[model samples]
Target: MKKFDVIIVGAGLAGLSCGLQLSSKGKKLLLLEREGVVGGRTSSYNLDGMDVESGFHRYIGYYTHLPRVLRKAGVELSEIFMWEEKIHVRVNDEKPLVLGMAPLFGMIKTIKGLVGNRRYLSLKDKLSLLPFFMNGLKDYVMSPHKLDQHSIKEYAAKYNVTNRAFHHLIVPLSSGVFFLPPERYSAYVFFGLLAPTIPKFYKMRVGAYLGGMTEVMCQPIADQIIKNGGSVRTHSNVESLVIEEGKVKGIRLEDGQVYRAQHTVLAVTLYTAKKLLKPVFENHPWFQPMFQLPLMPAVSFQIEMTKPAVPIDVTTFAPFTCLSSFAEQSRTTFQASKGRLSIILSPPEKFLDLDPQETLQFIIKDARKIGLDLESNILDYRQVNHEYDFHSLEPGFQALRPTQRTPVEGLILAGDYTRQPYFATMEGATLSGLKAASLIK
Candidate 1:
């Protein structure tokens, strides 16, 4: 029985950003979430006396909007410290090779390392990345919509990028961040990521929130939304959309409470949006595309040890390994040295169906490849799986995604999966949220 100018479902990055923007623009909005806390996957939890994120999250300097959104919430980017961009990629049983990404000219240094990497990449493999390097940063990241729709695997084959190149270089890079391998992703997404960081390729400038992402990013957004006269309700689930004559009427919650609004923003993940909106608005243009988009499942391993051994800020293991990216974040996650704590991001194939104890033990065994161990010094550990995360760009599936503004009247979509210039990521989530709010602005 509540009424507002706008009703936002799911207080994730997209929903929170949309609510904050709408409220600041003098609009009355109600933000609802099924969970007691907000921020979606960006949320963090305290474990072993340290703040551990849901997954390994790092802010690339190329993300132009994340900084702006944080500043609007009275936070400064300087609050977080920049990490030197040194990536260690281990290929099979061979020793890990380190890529130094600092000065603009340092790209050549890393390329030389790859070329000389006889066991992993060679001169031919290094030359195969010419297409990835040819696209200018502006064109690749901003204008990738027009590229011929092709799977990243297919595109790599056309360029003669060998499997060795893929297993050692491309897979770790693409799947490390995107969750799916080159075969499932679109070439545009590959270029979308390579465009921003490859030319100058300064990974050292990446930043992590000074006090965890939720406390520093999501909490501030929620605080601003409330300060602007908006109401954020947690543990409130909307069962279905109230539809009549192809237009959104309101929403009916699972508890039989009907909340009415002039406009409704479905800012949840793609899966939840499809479940709620399809049956209600079957004929809407957004319906068919929702089915085409996919979802991916992943797990994170949090390891607490008595001492520090893993020194790299961000490192990607080989494609054959169970882990994709590993980060040791004691500097940002704790008040002081609370023993060396690390986060391991892995694809579903690595930890699927494994119990928490089994998952933790498995990762510990795998960590030995990189000289990281917690078997003896293990103080605490936790494993989490994100069941409803979006599917990475699967072949031609990326093109079928709908934009933020749906064809249906009074309905707007906000999620990383919604078609946007940025790749599906936290930045994409923020942009999608802003785009949704702009529709009502």
Candidate 2:
């Protein structure tokens, strides 16, 4: 039998961030991960001497809390490279758009598509966004509470913006942020992402680890968790949460081993949380409401190439597939060290139905649309399709999401799935972990 002051489940960004904070306080902690790795969605893998990441992840220094956690865990800032102005987007029919540091030009481009749609907005309606758009996001951030209930589509419609503006600019931006369709997502998700699009105090740049994300971020926090008298158990699939007297007393492993702790953080997916919390969730009044909430599905595929495919450094947006954005990640691919290229393909649901070979063919076709030499390149590919990657925060979903505080006294909810300002991002996961740990004791 083993006991801990706090037991953090799931080694994802949220769990790791929570562990990082609590471990520093010297709390006897136990981090239980079903997988053998620490990085959840933000991790990477090795293939034929190449380091391939699960998806495209870029750290915007200002908006991301990951840097702070990394610094505390002994990760140096210099170890990561920052690209200040490197984001571009291309819509299906429109010209490729650049999102850079220009203030006035950026504003014009942001709302141009909205104004262009003839039926969507009146002259008066399109002009109204000018003040708020130009004034930056101070008013919005000061009152984020007001925007929480509104959908991104509603806001765009209210402003008389066209679907071109919504789909190409705002939708893609919001989709990349929430990993969900913009029409079905909350306005708060969009506002949160656009908040940083305004001018900032520090430099605005996209960042990445010198090594793969798993090595640079996940491994360090794992070491700190162990160094601070905490134990981490991987491959320990948790069968169910043990509850008695309306409290989380312990957890039952698939193999019948029982581990008890004073507190348990249900840091898995929304579906997994429901299953593990079934004992109490069956009778609890609030549980039924949670079950109705929709969980968003996210699927990503990675293609490895023996030669360079795309000449561009990194193209955030391309007019191919349902993918909102794409990035050229060379530093992580071991193949890059040997004059090879690796491209990450993030297509929409249409591509998910395609067979692996078909998916690969679609990606190659789309890559060519972006001026990538897909035909000449020769290599391997890998795909990961997880339905629980994100919880679909559809209309009225905000009301049903579980909070950091759960119905069970000793159990708290973690993971990016929790009610965080940002959704389906490393920052959101880290924030959830920190909030969960703060609730303990």
Candidate 3:
């Protein structure tokens, strides 16, 4: 048994962010990770002499608070390149529409790309999406508490969204964030993220590191924690929280090691959080909402290319199979010359049960819609699958989401999936970690 000021569970984004914030306060802490490494799902790995990422993630301008945290951690903004946000969307086999997001001042081009194309969203569909898109989310800002009960599908019906709009604009965007289709996820979470509460802050730039996200961000932050007198242990899978009298006294690892702390931050995924806290969650009123938060699987695929495949950078899909997002990520990483391409596909429900060969083939076929020819690539590759990660942005879960401050005296929650206005993203995770750390002192 060991004792510390705090025992942080799961070294993912929320855990690391919480540790970073606490370290700045001069609090001694321990970050425990189950895997062999410290980087979370967002972290990258070396595959076949090429650096590929856990997922193709970008730092969106609307993230608002992440830049400040990175600066404090000594991460140089110059190392991150702000690529023009050109999202090439493929609606079925039709022509892919490229929408430039860059500094996020591209609303007109975005509307023109989709609405003007009139292939994805028709004039009728734009008229339907008008009330929601008008003023860029004014209604959501006006009544922040409303629309949680309405799914995107239900809300779209009021606007009479066409099948093309539902499949192309609605489902693709909905699954991109919520991991569920528009019919399944809530309309409020969608608007809350896309609809800017602070237009000044929300209207920023989207960027990626010139190197691996792990090498550039996660590992650097981990080193910062060590520099600030905090301990981080990998291969330390935490089994459960040592709760007594409705308070978290510490945590127990799978190997039977016990680490005691005055405060504990359970920063694992939403599914893992519910599982670990099941003993209390089944009974506690405040914790009961943990069950309301549904879990969804996330899968990432990558391939090394001997020759250039897709000329464009990124493409999101929904014109065919369950919605998916894919990108030729080699351009951003320090290992750009290696020509690494990757994609973050949809639910385990659609492909989780498929064999590895079948899965790879499926993704390759999907990528071809945007002119991505991974099969022609002549090098090594890899795939990463997690049983759960994202939270359901679905209807009725808004009122159920718990905040960073928990009912237990020494316990707190920190994760992208936890209650955050940002939804399940790096922004939500960063903010959650900040709030969790603040709650302790």
- Candidate number of the best TM-score: 3
Residue-by-residue lDDT tens digits, candidate 1, 234-267:
8899999988787886888889999888899999
Off-target runs (Cα >4 Å) in candidate 3 are 46-51, 92-95, 103-125, 135-139, 142-146, 321-323, 334-337
**Deviation in Å, model 2, residue 76 alpha carbon:** 1.2
TM-score against truth, every candidate: 0.88, 0.84, 0.89
lDDT of 2 by residue, 81-132 (tens): 4343446665433435555432333445334544454333456554655643
Question: lDDT for each of the candidates?
Answer: 0.73, 0.67, 0.73
Candidate 3 per-residue C-alpha lDDT over 70-179 given as tens digits, one digit per residue, 9 for 90 to 100: 78789877776545455767765556766556434666665567547765566877676766565327656676566787887887777666766676677777776545
- Badly placed stretches (over 4 Å) of model 2 are 47-51, 91-96, 101-151, 162-168, 196-203, 332-347
lDDT of 3 at 21: 90
Please identify which of the two predictions, 2 or 3, would achieve the higher TM-score against the true structure: 3
Query: What does the lDDT come to for candidate 1?
Result: 0.73
